[model samples]
Target: MDRPWGVPSPIRPGFAQAETAVPLMNIANILTMLRIALVPLFVVALFVGDGHETGWRICAAALFGLAAITDRFDGQLARKYGLVTDFGKLADPIADKALIGSAVIGLSVLGDLAWWITLVICGREIGVTLLRLAVVRRGVIPAGRGGKLKTLVQSLAIAVLLLPLSGGFAAAGMVSMYVAVALTVLTGLDYVGQAARVWFAGGPGRARGA
Candidate 1:
């Protein structure tokens, strides 16, 4: 099919599945699964001691950083060498949500992050995840730049907050989280709009019209 409105079709990544669907145990998918596996380790370290205790917090941050780094590596490897599989497509985002969602919820439990911030961010994450699944057969709703930026901001916020910092650094982390929240909401709306066009307006066929 032709490109979608001069942008590559959101489902373009799915094409990787067609070409490299089998041999699913490639490096990229392994990295993604490793990321998923690290979530519990992160949680254990996070809650092993009182919330702001230095040692546990550092362990948690290191585990979180490792997991986050795996996320990038998996995606890069997937794209860099035709390694995307259906499992990777499904597991990658689930891994991300498991990691970040657990962190946010753990922070709320530890009284670091506000319950409402947790609610808003987690709610959007869940809802958009469901939205992606709902529309998957229609077309891919690939992550836009804004969505990636939001993830980066959220990850930075979580990392900083996990570091047991104080004063201005803590303040900056809070600000980063709020910015992430705003971008999350905005991108959620953007996804809805993009989905409407892709699935409802005969997305693939209309590429020529544009």
Candidate 2:
């Protein structure tokens, strides 16, 4: 049953019915959902800023930080409590993309960030997500360290760029944005290379029975 908060009280274990049942209300999934919910609040905060750069940055960073915290917690809880699910595998990344991508778009529209930066980041995200969906039927690829690093940098950059209204914050934002750009480029290459190896290199023969 789903709780008032929308979490299933007792999660069924595994994707297949033959698997044993487990509680779905694990901390990880809860945190993942919470992160998704926070995105709107972050957006409102960003837009509400009356030209206060520092205020905007701090609020945005706090939102991103909260999301980041949940990102880590959910994974840790899933692993520790044996509550990992296919739903989680799909929802986590989608939630992340939605949250971060929206922030990027919002910031870009506000001229706090360049459209090209958001474009590059969103492009990679959309591409990777599609690739994952394409290959999901065959096997699951656990999130790797490089992907994690990319997300971390992206979040930091978004936070830095959203400062409310401060010169020091702007300087910091510039530095962070450059770092994020580098990471974004590197990660895009890494994902493309991985896709090549998986699809072109005949890895697993095209996700199953192909």
Q: Give the best candidate by TM-score.
A: 1
**Tell me, what's the RMSD of every candidate?**
7.9, 5.9
TM-scores, all models, native as reference: 0.84, 0.78
Candidate 1 per-residue lDDT, tens place, 1-210, comes to: 442111222345558544433466777778888988999999999998576789999999999999988887777666655565656776888888888899999999999999999998888788877866766677655666787788888899999999989999999999999998898789878877887786785443111000
After superposition, candidate 1 runs with Cα above 4 Å error:
1-22, 201-210
Candidate 2 lDDT tens digits, 1-210: 232332234435564543434456556677878989998888887777463466665777788788767877677666655667777787888888888898889988887778998899888889878877876765555565677887887777776666554688777877887787787778777766666666654454211000
Model 1 residue 18 CA deviation (Å) reads 12
TM match of model 1 to true structure: 0.84
Native-to-model Cα distance after best TM-score fit, residue 107 in candidate 2, in Å = 1.0
**What lDDT would each prediction earn against the true structure?**
0.77, 0.71
Model number with the top lDDT: 1
Off by over 4 Å in 2: 1-20, 49-57, 199-210
